[model samples]
Target: MSRRQSELEGRLDDMLSRIAMETQEIKELEQQLTDGQILANEVLQRDLEGIISGLQEYLRGLRDQARRSQQQVDSLQAENQSLQLHLEDSQRHCRQLEDRARTHTQDMSVQQEELSVLRTEAHALRDRQVESSRQQEELEVELQQLREELARQVTLGQLERGALLAAVDKEKQSTEIRECQLQATIDTLQDEKSSLQQITLRLQAQLDQTRTQYTETRDHLDQTRLQLDRFTAAMLDPQEVQSGPDDLDEDKYRYHYYNFIFQQDLAPAQTARSTKTWFDVHAITVLDWPANSPDLNPTENLWGILKRKMRGTRPNNKEELTASIKEIWASITPRQCHVASRQ
Candidate 1:
C-alpha cells in the first residue's frame, strides 16, 4: 500500500508538471499576441497621424491655390473691364472718324464740281482774250498809220513855205520902201507863225504821250480788277474761308506797321537850349494816324527805350547802330506793347 501511494503521488506530480508547461507555453503565446496587438495599434496611430498631416498640408495648398486663383480672377476681371472701356472709346472714335470722313467726301465732291465749272469759265475767258487781242492789234496798226500821216503833212508844208519865201524876197526888192515895210511885216508874221507851229507840235506830242499813259493805266486797272474778281470768286464760300477775329486782328496789327515812322521831339518843360540838347531823350513820335489804330505801340516805344539805353554809349557807325537796334528790338515783349499802348 505504501508503494502504491508513492506511485500515485509521482503520477500526480508528472501530470502537474505537464499542465504547468502547457500553461507557460499558452502564457508566452498570449504575451506575444498582446505585443503584436500593441505594435499594430502604434503603427495604425502613426499612419493616422501621417494621413492627417498630409491632409492638412493638402488643404493648406488648396487654400493657397484658391487664393492665387481668386487673385488671378480679380486681375483678369480688372483687365477685362479696362479692355471693355478701351473698346468703347475706340468704337466712339471710329464713329467720329466715319462721320468726318463722310463730310470730307461730300466736300470733295462739291469742290470737284466747282472746279469743273471754273474750268469751263476759264475756257470761255481764253476765247474772249484771243478775240480781244485781234481787235487790239488792228487798233494799234491804225493808230500808227495816223501818226505817220500827220508827220508827212507837217514836212510837206514846211517845204512849200520855204519856196514861197524865196520867190517873194526877189520880187519885193524893186518896190523899194513899200516892199521893205511889207517884207518887215511878213518876216515878223513868219517868225510868229513858226513859233506857233512849234508850240502846236509840242502840244500834240504831249497829248499823244498822255493818251498812251492813260491807256496803259487803264489796262493795268482792268487787270487788277479781273484779278480781284477771280480772287473773290475763289474765296467766296464761308466754310472754305478760315478767316476769324484773330486773323482780322493780326491784319489790323500788321497794317499798323506799314507806314509807322518814329520821331522824337523835345519835352515841353525844357528850355530851348536844353531842349535842343536833349531833343531825342524820353520823347517818342508816331507818324501815322488812322481811324482804327491797333492798341499796340512797343515797336515805336522800344525805339525810345533803345535811345534811352544808348544815351551814354556812342555808336561808331551805322553797322553798330543797326546791331544795337536789333538787340534792343529782340528784347521787347508783347506785354511791353500792352503797357505802352495804355500809357
Candidate 2:
C-alpha cells in the first residue's frame, strides 16, 4: 500500500507539473498569435502546428490516464473495502486532471479560431495588393498617353507659329511696298497739281482781258447809237424858224430878216454846247401844232407809202419781211414826197 501510494503521488505531481507547463505554453501562444502572422515564415507556422498537435496529444494521453485511474478506483472498491478511501482520493485527483485537460482543449480551440481569423485577414491583404497593382498599371498607361498627346500638341503649335511668323513677314513686306508706291503717287500728283495751277492762272488772265475788251466795245457801240439818235432827231425837226419881213411878198425870193420856225416834237429838249447847233433854250409853241404831223413830214409820207404796200402782205419770216420792206421803199414815187412837203 505505501509503495502504491508513493507511486500515485509521483504520478499526480508529474501531471500537475505537465499541466502548469501546458498553461504557460498556451499563454505564450496567445500573446504571439496577433503579431506573429504578419512576419511569420512557413518554418514558424510548422513549429506552431507541431506544438499544438503535441499539446492535443498530451491532453489525449491525460484523458486516457484519467479513465484508467477511474477504472482502478472502481476495481479497488469492488475488490477491497479497506482500499476504498485511497482509491477515492486517486479518483478525485484523476477528475481534476480531466478537468484540466478539458480546460486545455478549450484554450486550444480559442487559439485555432484566432489563427483562422488571422489567415482570412492575410488573404484580404493579398487581394488588395493585387488590385492596387492593377490600378497602378492602368494609371501608368493613361499618364503615358497624356504625355504623347501633349508632345503632339506642342509640335503642332510650333508649326502653326512658324507659319504665322512667315505670313506676318510677308504682310510687312507688302505693306512697305504699297507705302512706297503711295508716296510716289502722292509726289506725282503734287507735281501735276502745280502744273494745273499755272494753267488756271493763265486762263484767269485771259478771262480778265476778254472782259475788258467787251466793256470797251460795248461803250463804243453805245456812243455810236447816241450819235445816230441825235442825227435822226436833227434831220426830222428844224432847229430854227425862218420868216421874212412882216409883210413879205409871196412872190419875192429875198427878205430883210428871215425867221426860222422849228417843229415842236423833234426839237432837242436838253441844252447842247456845240458851235454848229447853238440855239436858245426857249420852247416851241405846242398849242398851235397838230397832234400828228404825218401829212406834213416827207419821211412820214414815205413810211406811210411803204407800210400801205406791205400791210396786206404777211411775211412768214424775218428775211421775207426785210425783203418786202426793201421792195416797198424802192417803189416809192417822187409825187408822194412832193405831196407830203407843205408850208
Candidate 3:
C-alpha cells in the first residue's frame, strides 16, 4: 500500500513539471507576438505620416498656383482697361485730326476760288490795255498824215506872202505841241504795261506755290488712309500675326508668343534658341500633341475650328473670310472654354 502511494506522488510531480515547462513556452510566444504587433504599429504610423506630408505638399502647390493665377488675371484685367483707354484716346486724336483736315480742305477751296477770281480780273485788265494800245497807234498814224499835208501846202507857196508865212508859223507851232503830247502819252502807256506785267508774274508765282502745297496735303491724306486700313485689318484678324516659337524659323526661335489664359500669362524669359524681334501682344493658348505641353500659338485647334465655322461652305475671299470670322467668334460656348481651361 505504501509503494502504491509513492508511485502516485511521482506521477503527480511529473505532471506538474510538464505543466510548468508548457507555461514558460507559452509566455515566450506571447512576448514575441507583442513585439511583432508593436513593430507593425510603428511602421503603419510612419507610412501614414509620409502620405499626409505628401498630400500637404501637393495642396500647398495647388494653392500657390491658384494665387499666381489670380494675380495674372488681375494683371490682365488691368491691361485690358489700359488698352481700352488707349484706344479711346487714339480715337479722339483721330477725330481731331480729321476735323483739322476738313477745315484745311475747306480753306484750300476758298483760296482756290479767290485765286480764280483774281486771275479772271487780271486777264480782263490785260485785254482792255491791249485795246487802248491799238487805238493810240491809230491816232498817231492820223496825226502823221496831217503833218505831211501841211508841209506840202507850205512848199507850194501859192498864196499871198504875208498870209503864207503866218500859216507856216501857225502850222509849225501846232505840230511841235502835238509831238510833245504824243510822246507823253507813249511814256504813260509804257509804264502801265510794265506794271501789269509785274502783277501777272507775282500772281503766277503764288498760284504755283498754292498748287504745290495742295499736292503735298493730298499725299499725306493718302498715306493716312493706308495706315488706317492696315490697323483695321490687324484688329480684325489678330491670329494672322500670332505664331508659336516652334513654328518660327531657326533664326527667330528666341521669341515667344505672349499667352493670355483665363487666369494666367506665359512667355519666354530669355533666348534659348535664336534671336529676332517679335510682335509685342498677347496670344491664345494651345496644346502640343506629342509633348503634352501648353503653349501660345495663334493658328491652333481652337482658331481652326472658329475659322472652319466661319468658312461654312463659302468660297474664301476677303469679304467672306471677314464675315465668317465674326460669326464664328460670336458662337463660341462658355462651357467648351471651361473644359479647355482644365486641360
lDDT of each: 0.69, 0.70, 0.66
Off by over 4 Å in 2: 1-151, 240-343
lDDT of 1: 0.69
Query: Across residues 47-115, which tens digit of lDDT does each residue of candidate 1 receive?
Result: 756765675566566556656666877899999999999999999999999999999999999999999
**Residue-wise lDDT of candidate 2 within 3-106, one digit each (tens)?**
55557557766866776686577667756666555346445656766776786677667667766777888878777875777889999999999999999999
**Model 3: per-residue Cα lDDT over 146-223, one tens digit each:** 999988887666556778789999999999999999999999999999999999999999999999999999999977
Best by lDDT: 2
Q: Report how far off residue 64 is in candidate 3 (Å).
A: 1.6
How high is the lDDT of residue 49 in model 1?
A: 60
**TM agreement with the true structure for every prediction:** 0.24, 0.28, 0.22
Candidate 3 Cα RMSD (Å): 49.5
TM-score, ranked from best to worst: 2, 1, 3
Q: Which runs in model 1 stand beyond 4 Å of their true positions?
A: 1-62, 89-93, 142-343
- lDDT score of residue 111 within candidate 3: 99
What C-alpha RMSD separates each model from the true structure? 39.6, 54.0, 49.5
- Model 2 superposed RMSD (Cα): 54.0
